[model samples]
Target: MTEHVDVIVVGAGISGIGTGYHLQARCPDRTYMILEGRAAMGGTWDLFRYPGIRSDSDMHTLGFAFHPWTAAKSIADGPSIRAYVEETAREYGIDRKIRYGHHVKSAAWSTEDARWTVEATGPDGPVTLTCNFLSMCAGYYNYAKAYSPEFDGADSFAGRIVHPQFWPEDLDYSGKRVVVIGSGATAVTLVPTMAQTAAHVTMLQRSPTYIVARPGEDRVANWLRGKLPSKAAYGITRWKNVLMGMFFYRLARKKPAKVKERMIGMVRDHLGPDYDVATHFTPRYNPWDQRVCLVPDGDLFAAINAGNASIVTDTIARITPDGIRLDSGKDLPADVIVTATGLELQLMSGVAFSLDGQPIELAGRLQYKGMMFDGVPNLSSTFGYTNASWTLKADLTAIYMCRLLNTMTKRGLRQATPYNDDPTMKSESFLDFTSGYVQRAAASLPTQGERKPWKLNQNYALDVLALKFGSIDDAMRFSNPGRSKDGRSTDAGTLQTA
Candidate 1:
């Protein structure tokens, strides 16, 4: 017999766990289960085992709104974050509702039944389940694959080539020369970390990224933690960080040239007058065009200053047996080459979705309030912000989802679908980011409108106002409380609201 739940959450990561908490706290009567494909929880934290793996965003904001991060370090390591997520799950009893090793294959929505029939591959074999609502918190990246561009003569490299997503546990790099490719977060992290034990490390990049250094600990937060309660301190610090981040982002956007000058000057100060700041640290685009790489306490800069690591700004010519040959005719000899490339962006965790026997092409659909897709009934996917910390948006989304669920229950509605009624509403890319990963998967992502409810503001303060307090009935069509399986109304049912 197939089991049934009020809601089925896709992944048991931060988003899923947070959603679980909200459902329990706000909608105590609703039953939900989390289906995680992996053996353990902590999705990204558990998957990535690379060195110097830490959050670019501060923990105070990255941590859940309800949970307070008690750690001294604002820039937390991966293991600590994994533990924090697990601890939150255990505290709220969300871990008990998770079904491990359940890889969801596909979902079919039935308008007549007003529920989703979900199929998955479990340890035994194929398993079937049903849910009134399906919440996809499976993250935005492909876990099994990393975005690795084709490098010429890669096969003839002769040395071990490793991707950061699938770092080997036993591979030793002690006292070995390592060359890390890319200038994003992963490359910036790996360069300093590998440089510690390696004989030498070099970061190779096609273009420079905006890299900034910040202290690992927040002094104000630390002081507030001692004087105030944990929750109060956390709340204050979270808002403080949020406001500061918003201010800087607005400043960057409004005065790009001025902000760019200040940012590049900071890098120059770090590397001294002799270092080639323009070539190695200055980015072609303005700040936040892509994400700015954050190095805790200037660790990456320190590594370079100590002669432990170096940066090379050039394109790859080809891979030789000994090392990589650059376009500038420089040979970077390496014992190990780490491809700290970007991630393979995936939508709804690449699960095949269908609605009432018709396949759902997400790319062609419009995003509704950055959560639900237009014309898709009883489904919502959690996609966080590109500008700010992911959890800021994620927390608001979970809260909004609870509000939606409660509203549906109160109105005796079984189906809630977003409809884009305005034909003149122009569609735009799902994300405004110019990052390579986003651009690579642009054709596969959903679209947004040029106006409210369909447009993503990317601002946490604005998102909080829109998601937390916004009207739930705007542009949303709700129906199907007493409808038959044959697409006929069995009773008059509740009034249809849009």
Candidate 2:
């Protein structure tokens, strides 16, 4: 027998857990279940187990708003983050609502019935489930595979190669020379951590990225925790971090040159006056052009100063038997190589979606409010901010989703579809980021509108004002295929034909 529910939430990650909580809190009458493809609760945190795996964003804002981040350190490791997520799940009884090893294969929305029929491979094999609304918190990247570009002679490398995404538990790198490719967050993180034990570590990059060092522990938060109550301290710290982040991002955009100089100066201070700051630290683009890389407490620089780690900016020619050969006529000898390149951006976990057996081409659809798609009924996806803490927007998304669901209940509406009829409205690529992961999949991802409501706002303040209390009915057509509890029939509106 097929199971029926008011809502079906895919993925049990941070966003998914928050989604479930908001559903239960705001719409107590609604029944919802979280279908997680993995057996674990923490999605990215659980998947990445490499050395120095930690949050690039501070925990103050990265943490859920509803929960208090009590840890002393604002920058937390993978295991600590995983434990925190599990704590939230257990506290809210969200763990029990999750169905592990349930991979959603496809979903079909029926216009006549105003319901979604979902097909998935559950732990017990093929299972069918029906729901009035589908919440996609599955994230945008593929968890099973990470992006690793092929080198000319990668197959000939005798040394061990590992991607931080699938780091092996039994693997040993102690006293070994390590080479990490890609200068993004993963490489910066791995370099210092591996340098502590590894004989030497090299961060190989095609181009430079802006890197800044920050204290792992927030002295203000610690001071507040001692002076104020737990909740009050957390709230203050969260707001402080949020406001600071907003200011920094705005300043970077308004005066990229000044911000760039300041950031470079900070890096120079970390690496000292004699260090080759221009060679390894200076980036071609302005600060905040791509996501800034954060190094906790100057550990990466300290590692470099201690002569355990080094940075090489050059193109790769091919892989030699022992190590990597660079286009700069230099070869790096190594015992292990880490491809901290990037992640394969996957939309909806590669699940197919159709409306009445007709395939839904995401690229053709309009991204409404950065959450819902134009002409898609009773369905929403959780996409967070690119500039600030991911959960800051994610938490707001949950609250807004709950608001939408509750509105549907009150108005006796079985469906809420974003309808765009303006011919003059312009469409653009989904993300404004120049990051490799985003640029690589920019063409395949969904398109956002050029104006408000449709445009995906990266500013947390604007998003808070818009999504938290914005009109849910505006630009959205609500209807009831079946008779509502209040004896109302479906409303009228025709979807714009492509």
**Winning model by lDDT:** 1
Error of 2 at 354 (Å): 0.6
* Alpha carbon lDDT of each predicted model: 0.91, 0.89
Q: What's the C-alpha lDDT at position 331 in model 1? A: 94
Q: Write the per-residue lDDT of candidate 1 for residues 179-246, one digit (tens) a residue.
A: 99999999998999999999999999999999999999999999999999999999999999999999
lDDT by residue for model 2 over 91-182, one digit each (tens)? 99999999999999999998778899999998889999999999999988999889999988888999898999999888799999999999
lDDT, residue 278, model 1: 88
In candidate 1, what residue range of length 10 has the lowest lDDT sum? 489-498
Give the Cα RMSD of candidate 2: 2.8
- Give stretches of model 2 more than 4 Å off: 482-498
* Top-TM-score structure, candidate number: 1
- List clash counts for every candidate, in order: 0, 0
After superposing candidate 1 on the true structure, give the runs of residues whose Cα lies further than 4 Å from its correct spot: 481-498
